[model samples]
Target: MSEETRDEPQEQSLFEAPPMAEQERMVEAILFATAEPVTIRELTGRMPHGSEPREALEHLRRRYEGRGVQVTRIGEAWAIRTAPDLGFLMRQEVVETRKLSRAAIETLAIIAYHQPVTRAEIEEIRGVGVSRGTIDQLIEMDWIRFGRRRMTPGRPVTFVVTETFLDHFALETARDLPGLSELRAAGLLDSRPPPGEGEEDAEGEEATDEGQEDLFEE
Candidate 1:
C-alpha cells in the first residue's frame, strides 16, 4: 500500500541468508573439495555474511552418519573422511613412497610422545646416537618438524610431530597415542628388557634407508 512498506520487504530479502538446506549444501561442497580438515572460522569466512556454518555442519554430520563417507572431527577442525569400517576398501589405493628404518621409527616415537625434545634428549632416551639422516627423512615426510629451541645451554632445536602425523593417524592430538600398558596389551611390546647399547647400534646399522621395510602399512 505504501512505497516504504514495499521497499522494506525488498530490503529484508537482500540481506537474508539462504535457507538451512542451501547452507548445508554450501558446507558440503567446501568440505568435499578441501583435502585438509577445515575450521569453523575458515568456513565462516567463506560462507555468506548471514550464514551459520556451525549449525550447517551439525546437520550435515548427522545426515552422513551411516554413509560410506562421513563428516569427522580432527582436533579443532572438521573433515569428510571414509567411514572407519569402510577404510579397508580404500587401502588398496594407498602407495608407499619410501621406507623408515628402525632408528627412524624410534626417533619418531620419542619425538611424538615427548615433543619439543632436542636431539641430545632423544639420544638419551634411546641410548644411541641419532643419525642426521634419520631426522632428515622424517622431516622430508612432513610427519615431523623442528619446534622451538630450548632455553637452556646452547638452545638446541627441538623436534615435534606435525598435523600430517595427527591426520594420518586420525588422532585429535598427541594425547591420543596409546599408553605403554595399551601397547603391551596389544602385543606391540615385549616383556623382555630393551637391547643393550651394542645391540641397538647393530639394529640401527642393519636397518639402513635402502634396506628398510615399508613405513606406511597401506
Candidate 2:
C-alpha cells in the first residue's frame, strides 16, 4: 500500500544489482572467447560462477534482437551474427559459389572436425565406405585436400582441410575448427557416426579410441 513498496517490481529480477553495461560486456566476452558455436548451456556455465547467465543472455538477445549485431541460434547452438543488411560486408570481391551433396557435407564436417584424418578414419566416422569419387568430389570443390604422410610404413598419406574450406565456412583457418573438447561440449557428436565402412577387417585393421583408423588398415 506504501509508495516505496509500489515502486518496486512484483517479481525480483534474476540478475542482482550488477550494472547493465557490465552484464552486456560479460556476454560479449563469452561470445568472443569461445571459438565454437556456444549454446545457452555453455553460456550459463561460464557465468559469475554463482550468478546465472540465462536470464542475462535472454535479456541480451532481446536487447540485440533487431540491432546491427544480433545473437542467433543454429540448431541448439548460438552465435552473434551481423545483421542481414551487412551481409554485403562479408562478400568477397571475387565471387564463386560451390554446391555439395549430403555425403560431401557429411564428409567435409568430419574432415573439419577431425583433421589430419585419413580416408579410413573418414570412412569409419561416416560408417560407410567413402567413395574414392567422394574424395575426388571434395578435391574438385577445393574444400578438402591431402596432407603429408603419417610417417608410418608405406608412408600412408593423411588428409587435412584446406584454406578454402575455412573460407567457405566463414572461419579464419583450420585452427578455428572446434576443438574436441568444444565439440563434445556442444553435444553435436551425439548423432551416430554413421554406419561402418565394413571392409574385410584384419586384427590390425579397426578403429582406435581416438577414432583414428588402425595402423594396418591400408
Candidate 3:
C-alpha cells in the first residue's frame, strides 16, 4: 500500500512548469518572433500553465544586458531591439515622401511633454493656433491619439503620445524624454522662437509644407 502511495504521481509536481532557465528561453523566443512590444499578460497567456512570465522576463532582461540585441520595455510591453549604438548601421536611404513641418514638430513636442493636454492648452503654450492638418498628420502617423476629455467647460478633448511613439523612440515612458540641452544638441528643438507665433493663419500655411524635415522618423 505504501509503495502504491509513493508511486502515485504528486499533484503539484505533475502540474509543475519548466525550470526558470527554460522559461527564459520560451520568453526569448516569443519576443524574438513578435515585431510588436508584448505585454506581460500576453506573454503569460502564451506560456504554459504555472509559468511565470514576469519572472522570466526579469531573467531574460538581465541575461541580455550588454548584448547586441537587448530586451527593452516600451511602456508596459517588452521587445527585443538592437542596441542604440548599432542603430546607425541599420539605416538605409529611402525616398522622402512627407515630413513634419515646424508647426507639426512643435505641436508634437508640446503634446509629448505635456500629455493629456487639450488643444487650447497646446495653443496657449505655443502661442499659436494649432492647425487641424498638423493634428491630423500626427494622428495618421500613429504617434499621438485623443486622450480623455477635460472636466472644464465644453469638455475639450486631450491628446497624448501613443505606445508607437514610445516604441519608435525606444522609450520606456514619456518621462524618459530628453532634457532641453539634449533636444538642442539633437537639433530637435530650436532656441529661436517659432517663425510665426501668435499668428493663427501662418501655421496653416506651414502645415501644408511637405518638404519640411521630419523630426520623428520610422
Candidate 4:
C-alpha cells in the first residue's frame, strides 16, 4: 500500500470530530434554539461522536458570563437564559400582564404557603370550597402542580407550587417566600374576613392527618 493511502485515513481521523471551539458554538446553538434546558447527555447524543459537550458547555458558559444572556443550569440540565440583571429587559419586551381573579390569587397564595396540601386542606384553610376553575387556572398558568396522594382514606391527590412559580417570583426555594406579616404589609393578604365569613370552621379546626402535615417540613 502506498504511503499516501495510509496518510488518507490519518487525515480523515483529524476531521472526524469538530474542534472544541466549534463544539462550543454547536452547544451554544442547541441551547439557544431549545426552549427547555438540555442535559449534557442530551447534548452529547445530538453532537458528533467524540465531541466534548461538557467541556464545550463550560467554555460557552464562561463566554456568556457578564453578558446579557447566560448559560444556566437547572437541576441536571443546561439552558441559555437571560442574565439575572438583564431579565427586566426581556420582561419589558415580552411579558404580557394578566390580572388574576380574587379566587385564583387567594388559591395561589394558599398553595404557595402550604404546598403539598390536599384540596380538603385548602378548603379548610380558606373556610370555603375551592372551585375547580381556580385550581385549573393556576395549573394552566404553570404556577401549581399536582403532588403525590395522601396516605389517608380515599388517598386524595395533593397540590404544590411548581418550579416555574419559584422562577417567576425569583425564589430559590419555597422558604424564600415572604412571611404572613410581609404579605399583610404588602396588602396581598387582608386582616379582615373574606366575603362569607361565617360559612366554614376557623383555621386548624379540621384535624390534619399524621403524615400529610409534615410534607413541606424540609
In lDDT terms, which candidate is top?
3
Show the colliding residue pairs in model 2. Answer: 127-195, 127-196
**Candidate number with the higher TM-score (2 or 4):** 4
Model 4 agreement with the true structure over 25-139: per-residue lDDT tens digits: 9999999998867889999999998799999999998998999888887546788777767655664564445555455655676787787899999888766778787788789
RMSD of each candidate relative to the true structure: 8.6, 15.3, 7.5, 8.8
Model 2: per-residue Cα lDDT over 1-218, one tens digit each: 99999999788656575565676678778876765557667866776544446566677779887788777554355567676566567656436444443455556667777788887887787686766766888888776788988877777677877755554344555545544333333332332343764222222243322442221112
Q: State the lDDT of candidate 3 residue by residue for 69-151, as single tens digits.
A: 99999999999999978765665533333444567777887888789999999889767788798799899999899999999
RMSD of 2: 15.3
Clashes of each: 0, 2, 0, 0
**Residue 62 C-alpha lDDT in model 1:** 100
Q: Please report, as a residue range, the 10-residue window in candidate 4 with the lowest summed lDDT.
A: 204-213
lDDT rank order: 3, 1, 4, 2
Per-residue lDDT value at 153 in model 1: 89
- Each prediction's whole-model lDDT (CA): 0.75, 0.61, 0.78, 0.71
Model 2 stretches astray by more than 4 angstroms: 1-85, 88-97, 175-218
Residue pairs that clash (backbone atoms under 3 angstroms), model 1: none
Ranked candidates, highest TM-score first: 3, 1, 4, 2
Query: Whose TM-score is higher: candidate 3's or candidate 4's?
Result: 3
**Candidate 3 lDDT:** 0.78
List the lowest-lDDT window of 10 residues for candidate 1.
209-218
